[model samples]
Target: MIRRISAALLALGLATAAFAQAAWTDAEVRKVDAKTGKITLKHGEIKNLDMPPMTMVFTAKDKALLEGVKAGDHVQFAADKDAAGEYVLTAIQQKK
Candidate 1:
């Protein structure tokens, strides 16, 4: 009985963690500076960051994250605050 209760609790924890994961935001690319590893975007509200819709620049966590992206492209992305407290683009993909 104790083992079953523990297993149930573990599963619940895992499910909650998955559900709490950051959501992707819709954005329009305003510029991509591969040289600086930065992208400017006019983006919708970033629910995870509690940010409202606005145009802003974000450093890409990896230069590769800028690949295939260009100005005027519609994309979906996820961002997070880095150790420096600056927003960093963590994931990005061209919208279908």
Candidate 2:
């Protein structure tokens, strides 16, 4: 019974984490630095990274991620820690 309970708990924890990480929150582009593939965003809850709503700068996995985005644009973006140990954008798009 104890083992079963532990397994259930573990599964629940994993599901919650996956759901959090998969969710994308809204943000406003404060700045876009195309040369460096970085952008400043004032974002809502980033549960995947355990970040609260705030303004900060982040690097993108690909420079092209910033190609058509500009300052003051509302966007939805996914961010994750890269192998280099920096949090970078995995995906992004302009909000409609």
Candidate 3:
């Protein structure tokens, strides 16, 4: 029983690590929502190894980071998967 419990914990740790996201690019920003810290981004095509091509709205962590950016500006951004597994922007920079 102890061995099984250990194995289960190990598996859980691995699963958590797998879900912890590294980073991603937004490609472009379509809209900015400061009130809720959500951004509508026209992102580049993302073909995840475990998923398929898709585009959607993303919530960013720092709404202030979008100060000078506009709907048309291209940005190289990074995101982290939230508790619910939805992508949330964590870092970003304007792409010249």
Best by TM-score: 1
For model 1, residues 1-96, the per-residue Cα lDDT tens digits are 999999999999999997567588999999999999999999999998999999999999999999999999999999999998999999998898
Judging by lDDT against the true structure, name the best candidate.
Answer: 1
Q: Model 3 shows how many backbone clashes? A: 0
C-alpha lDDT of all candidate models, in order: 0.94, 0.91, 0.71
lDDT of 3: 0.71
Ordered list by TM-score, greatest first: 1, 2, 3
Q: Where is model 1 more than 4 Å wrong at Cα?
A: 1-21
Misplaced by over 4 Å in model 2 are: 1-21
Query: Candidate 3: TM-score?
Result: 0.61
Candidate 1 vs candidate 2: the lDDT winner is 1
Q: Is candidate 1 or candidate 3 better by lDDT?
A: 1
Clashes within 3 Å, all models in order: 0, 0, 0
TM-scores of the candidates in the order shown:
0.79, 0.75, 0.61
lDDT of model number 2: 0.91
